[model samples]
Target: MHARPEAWILSIGNELLVGRIVNTNASWLARRLTFMGFNVSRIITIPDSIDDIVLEVRRGLGKVRVIITTGGLGPTHDDVTLEGIAKALNKNLILNSEAYEMIKEFYNRRNMPLTRERIKMAYMPEGARALRNPIGSAPGCIIEVDSTIIVSLPGVPREMEAIFEEEVKSILEIIAPKISIVECSLKTRGIPESSIAPFLEHIAKSHSNVYVKSHPLGFELDKPILELRLLVSATSEDTAKGIARSIMEDIIREVLKLGGSTSSEYCV
Candidate 1:
């Protein structure tokens, strides 16, 4: 049996693309998903443009099992993620009364008038399931279409993190099979990248399920250290972690066997 490749993150907002905002949402989502043992296969950023969003959605749907999008989901003219998702799936945005009432209450609580524009935040792609925004005005949505699960969350990091943690987490746990990609690393001193290439390659071929890479720091500054990472992708966290742990143990054993000093981190 084999594990399915799962979960891609899509970030939406013109601010992100134009560099007005650094995309903390993607990293936050990835870290959370990784902790939950979901394979964070890919992460991409796009503008608020519908065409761009739809294109990325279609492309991601083909490759990843679950698609989680953040940003462009608010009660404003520029918030077009809902329509983009609907178009990508060939659906329409329809008014969701539950969401409508929620949005209404949001305004009422703040002592603000519910303008027709703000109330429109209740509209969702037809057949989309609403994921309540416990902290924000816009309700996120989860739609199951063509075997792919799409979850949309607010772009604001706090709100996005909240909804993902509170709402989408349990739902995905129910629908998604257990899977994980785990990795552990070793920091080697007195070793250069060129010197470790063959060893890295040897380890990689021996474990087809694992990947190895070396990163060098401070090469131009006359002092450089090499980092070797052993990445393992498996169907479950235990399997992935087990493999990673085994490899790390083997590397430690080898270094100790050779009377060479190794460290968990490179020191200055």
Candidate 2:
């Protein structure tokens, strides 16, 4: 009944900016958030600068309901995401007892001594709650500012995904309880995107809850090929699934009418 919550993703690290490492975190988060019935508006990639991080966080908080940042949560000196968050929210950087305990246990299990750098990971923005990272030493954090939730996760793909699945997913489920999203994809062999553009536009306009997109795969012989993706969000699973099925049927019918052939089965 209400509009979907808007989300913004921020990726921080000089490695991402300089191409030293690929920024797969943004794409992963975007896809997951979209499938969870969120309107992912923008993805921003910035260097590991405290000022830039603080500025972006402040700006994103003004617009989006949820902001997720990946990277810069390590024990190294360049790991300044917590500092930026604290500065932006006017909160003090203090030792979080929960985070300290988690870090201590993790290091102790590995028989690693607690060094100064390792201790830095326990300092988080005041009033922030730590999200346990089962796979890594750096614990993620969540803080609310002006009713907007900001989540900080590690840069490593494995650790980030673990924290998101184990901790953040439950929080989001509670925040947006009424949304149910369903998606279906159709792969066609002989249809060009240009030919199906008008039909997709019409379907999108007529069905406001349904999102139709065409992705052009490479040509097969002389024929242009593409995949059609359909997504729907509703208050219930049955409604969402039904809408997606109906849309897929309509698309298949149109493709057949246009003399185009499909090589793949409908996937939901």
Candidate 3:
């Protein structure tokens, strides 16, 4: 396995487009992938249209090494993800035998009708790898387009989470082969991006390999909080941990001196 350049997450669903859904899938998966040491380039939300889906997939292929798409893999008319992905890659949509049988068994177990529409969940693009979904009927697929690995998962958060854990996570672990890519995150209270920009600029310039990102989640007890991400690249877990720890200590001291109190030295 070789190194992963990065991942571009494209979350689909008309609900997400019209603001019916908040797109928690992309945010959740992005943070998970980043913490696992695979870089996430961008998170985009698009409507359930073939032209738009293919366009975004084609565009993301050029910029990122991987693409993970969520939504539209259900048994409804709007469940057009399979069709769009096939159209994008000029691939054929065929029913996966295993997935078909799995869905059949599910309906049989429930004593429900084996309708053709319900079986639609088993269809996938030709030459694509199916990602098993133990929790739902919609089986996901991982395909390669222009040398980019594109993962299509169900829209349901629990189902998406299961397929990714079963399919994508292990693949990334194999590709990266980290003896230990240790990371440390610091959660600080009452600090805005403006106040930390200059300090982060210096830190970033000094440590090019160490990545830092701030996520503002309104803090506990009515105080605003920012989570500082400190990622280090090293061959060993201990070495990576040491590098992250050192960088974290420096940032904590600097932020404290700047009148921003830290809620944690290491956030998990």
lDDT of 1 by residue, 171-252 (tens): 8777655656676777765556676677677788888777778888545345346677776767767888777887777766
Sliding window of 10 residues with minimal summed lDDT for model 2: 259-268
Models 1 onward score TM values of: 0.86, 0.95, 0.86
lDDT per residue as tens, model 3, 128-167: 8778888988888887767778889999999999998887
Which sections of candidate 2 miss by over 4 Å? none
Give the TM-score (vs. native) of candidate 2. 0.95
Q: Give all candidates' CA lDDT scores.
A: 0.79, 0.90, 0.81
Model 2: per-residue Cα lDDT at residue 153:
99
Model 3, position 46, has a per-residue lDDT of: 90
**lDDT by residue (tens digit), candidate 2, 1-268:** 2278889999999999889988899999998888787888889998888999889999987678899999999999999999999999989999999999999999999999999999999999999999999999999999998878999999999999999999998898777547788878888878889999999999999988888899998898989888888878888889888888888888889999888987675645
Q: Model 3, which residues run further than 4 Å from truth?
A: 1-4, 177-181, 187-196, 213-227
Model 2 lDDT on a 0 to 1 scale: 0.90
- lDDT-superior candidate, 1 or 3: 3
| Backbone atom clashes (below 3 Å) for every candidate | 1, 0, 0
